[model samples]
Target: MPSSRPRCSAGSSSWSTAAATPTSSARIAVSIERSRPEAVAALALDAYGLSARERQIAALLLAGLSTQDIAARLYLSPHTVRDHVKTVFAKTGVRSRPALTAALRPI
Candidate 1:
């Protein structure tokens, strides 16, 4: 038996469906376009003039890492990470982590 599912054209949007076989069963495939986080971070870095270390710290901060966590990941002292966080806040004109995150978060 032939499947009753609708056939999707090549010009269709991200989501499209096609007949799998000459049977009642059909499979649907969906294509999703996602913005790269690195691209967003690069833009932010350029806009804010953040140093390489600062950008690294900012990325970790946005990922919900604490000072100690970020330091541990980077093999740095917690104090050093805290200093970078402070610099990031100052350069971004944000007073706190949440504010920095909100200011730099990708749309």
Candidate 2:
């Protein structure tokens, strides 16, 4: 059986370290140290300037799903997934998913 518990990476220099979990197949649940939630929010805002849905998509992308896989999981059409990816690229100023992930990384 697949483990439900998530693997966590210690956050970057700008944010405090805390445990995070992968909850539903849809999204991960991260428990940031109390002092750092605001900073995390700020970093997310700065990096992608994404709406909540876009941010969720970007997060899923970072978790490494192909467009088709993303579509299947998100219940979106593949074309819609591609469109969101395009918007994600434009908003984050990154041409590719790897770049987008790197950009989303902590400062």
| Candidate maximizing lDDT | 1
- In candidate 1, the residue pairs with backbone N, CA or C atoms under 3 Å apart (3 or more residues apart, or in different chains) clash, namely none
lDDT digits (tens) for residues 4-58 of candidate 2: 4222335453555555566669666656543344345345645557777787678
TM-score of predicted model 2?
Answer: 0.60
lDDT of 1 by residue, 84-105 (tens): 9989888989898888777766
Local distance difference test, candidate 2: 0.68
49 in model 2: Cα distance from truth in Å?
2.6
- Scored by CA lDDT, what does every candidate get? 0.71, 0.68
Off by over 4 Å in 1: 1-34
Q: Estimate TM-scores for all models.
A: 0.63, 0.60
